[model samples]
Target: MNQSAAFSPLHRLWHSRRFRGLVPPALLLVLWWLATTHEWVSPLVLVPFGQLYDAALDPQVFHSLAEGIASTFGRLLQGYGIGIGIGLALGVGMGLSKAFDRIMGPSFHAVRQVAILAWIPLLTAWFGTGDLCKIVFVAIAAAKPVVMGAFEGVRSTPAQLLEVGRVLGFSRLKMLRWVILPSSAPAIVTALQLSLIYSWFAAIGAEYVIGVMSGGIGSVVMGAQEHFRTDVVLLGVTLIAATGVAMNKGLRGLPDYLFRWRTRA
Candidate 1:
């Protein structure tokens, strides 16, 4: 191949979505290194990238991080699972029945209007600094987006489709199964993705607020902060960011696989 031809594909690949997406973070990392190396910021405030990298590799730091991740993940799963169940049920109920909507919609909206973090004080007071409080907080954070997404999905179902189901002599249950659910599959998947993102943030925030004694990434960060271990804190932040990105990417794959027909259409 000619030199131009050989380079052309590489050039195009560099501009592709995945490669483009990496540029900003790469630049930020470069900037961070510059800032630390040149003392643009004090080493105490922003540890050198080299120090952070070294801390991450330390056996003691690695073990603590592994344990923290496992503990946080367990709580996140518990809370997020509960939230999804409750949100799906409420969303479906409100979407399907005017009476149910009238009864529950106002209350749901009212509760949702309050920020999830605002509940932390009350939860802390009620449940103490225990895992229960953190779990409940994560659940609340996860449920709101899910409930709204599911409700919107069901409500947006085409009337013609429902009529077709009726014409085919589908009972309410059958109509729900064949028409409502299939139609709402996209929204449900979107909700789950959003919920997953929210739950991670919530879980971390909850752990931070509850303190290191509670145990998790948040606790690790907080503990590091207490001792002014900026390297460890930055490391925790980096780990959280990387994990969130990986999780989002993983979840994004599911909808693509499940609804590949949409792309073909």
Candidate 2:
């Protein structure tokens, strides 16, 4: 009975998603400790955990991190919402109307081929390196993936599904809400997930490049770099990476949840 009880807990832990996900981080922590302890790298490049911990405990550092995260998340959420909203509408129109597609699709494709960073100069020229510019840049980065995902998803909807919608006398709005969206739930979810990831990256990139001095997580890194604070830099980077991983994990099951009707049927 004791053996069975011990084995049961171990087996459950071994199979749990949280445990599986933690393995890589645990390994990384071990490696980081080994490297720092042995001075495998220059202290300037990688600081010891003790130093990192001390930096985190500092009141000023804590306040800066909190404010930085708040600023960054503010810009991220606003720009991301705007981007995905516009992108979804445009993509759906293109997929639903051949005339609209023919007119806009070519230009969109041509524009997409241009490197994202290349637009920074143009956008900066128009928006003038302020919050507006950073938000616009982040929006642009987020929109592309959403546009592509939504377009492809809608285009791929089965003809039979459309026929069923028509037979049921669904209006355009009804068809879209009931048949189109649900049919393309997986693709839409994928697009949204990718958009979120890209937006976070773009939010940081915009702050780093735009240099608006508005205070973001990117500013923390920039400040640390300017002052040669390796521990602070590591803290900022770890925070950014952790938030991104959490966002990705949180959205991983969305498609399954949204499309459960198919599974049940």
Candidate 3:
């Protein structure tokens, strides 16, 4: 057999979709190394890659990182779950009934216009800068995207499909179960992904605000900044970005698996 005819497993692996996605990050890492090595920016402003890696791996720092991640993840789940539930309920109701849409649409849009951060002060006052306030802030951040996604999904469901359901004499429940829900699955999935991302960001932001008393990755980063531990701050940022990417990939897998047919078509 010709040498070229024999496929190289390593070559194939390198060109694989997952591996290809790492190219940009790898390039960025190289750029970061260059910038730091040449003193494009002072070490104080941008810690060298070596120091950042060392700080990230340090046992003491690792312990704090682990604790902060665990706390933040727990709060993310709590807030995200609550927000998703409420968004789904409202979206479904508004989508299904014209009267409901008319009654709630204006108020919903109006409220959504308010910035997520704006609610933080009121929430802090109401909940007293504890886990509850942070959770509520995260929930608010997650809910807006979810509700919008759900609403758009439901509204965009084809009228022909509904007509088909009607022609088949399907009851409202049956129509919703078989027709509406399936049609809206994609939108809901997208919304879920958005909500998850928003929740993570909100959780971090809330932690940064309340984390001095409470504790999370945000708090760790803030404390590091106060103490002039730039390496630790960079480590926290890296962790947050990596976690966000991991979460998006994980959540995306579900929809991709469930909706494989859409891609096949």
Candidate 4:
């Protein structure tokens, strides 16, 4: 083909959705290669992709990855379960009672503004560097989002529906079961997804700071830093990002599958 025909073919491919999805990553890799080649970043700081892949396949590398994944996921699940459970209960209470919302909301908001890292010193003192500390950190990270989501979901429930339930002589339990829970399901699920993601990041951060011999992914990142292995650091980072994406897919997929009716206006 002549230059014009070639240009047309390129345009068509560029406009294709699947091809478009690949372009940004392809461009980023190219940019990374060029940047590394030109010494735009120090070699110690930015390892080339080839080195990363090679190191990744080594048995030591595989072992570290496996250990890190297991440790991080374990702590995350523990904290996430506790945090979401408590948050949802508190949220329901706050949503139902104006007096409770008035009393608890300010304190809750104040605590939420404090970063999880800031709480590390006190938590470490109380819980030591054990699993409890890490679990607390994850819970702290996950709880706010869950509380906010659930609170909003419950509070924003339609007044008319609540009145209708009262007219039907529904007890408080029946009202919550029939009217509130179903109406709030989407928002609660959204909160769970957010809490889970926050918990994942929190577990890794806690591991990096407090964990020893636990073999969490965060610890792997820490080890990479200690050893000045930028290639391994990047690989750890890549794995975390990939895992987060996978978790998001699984969590969100269930709601989308089961509640297709909710999507309609």
Model 2: residue 43 alpha-carbon error in angstroms: 2.5
Top model number, TM-score:
1
If scored against the real structure, what TM-score would every candidate get? 0.90, 0.87, 0.84, 0.87
Per-residue CA lDDT of candidate 4, range 35-87, in tens? 88888998787877778889988899888888888888888999999899889
Give the per-residue lDDT digits (tens) of candidate 3, residues 1-265: 5665566777797889988998998998899899999899887788887798799779999999889999999999999999999999888889888899999999999999998888877887799998998888888888888888888888899999999999999999999899999999999989989899989999998988765668899888898999999999988888999998898879878888989999999
Q: Which run of 10 residues does model 2 get worst, by summed lDDT?
A: 180-189
In candidate 4, position 122 carries an lDDT of 94
lDDT values of the candidates? Answer: 0.91, 0.89, 0.89, 0.87
Q: Across residues 232-260, which tens digit of lDDT does each residue of candidate 1 receive? A: 88888888898998998899899999999
Off by over 4 Å in 1: 1-17
- TM for candidate 3 is 0.84
Worst 10-residue stretch by lDDT in candidate 1? 205-214
* Clash totals, every prediction: 0, 0, 0, 2
TM-score of 1: 0.90
Locate the minimum summed-lDDT window of 10 residues in model 4: 207-216
* Ranked candidates (TM-score, high to low): 1, 4, 2, 3
lDDT of 2 by residue, 1-265 (tens): 9999989989999999989999998999999899999999898988899999999999998888888989999999999999999899888889888899999999989988988789899998999888898888888888898888888888899999999999999999999999888777688779989999989999998888888488899988898889999988898998998898898888888878877888999
TM-score of 2: 0.87
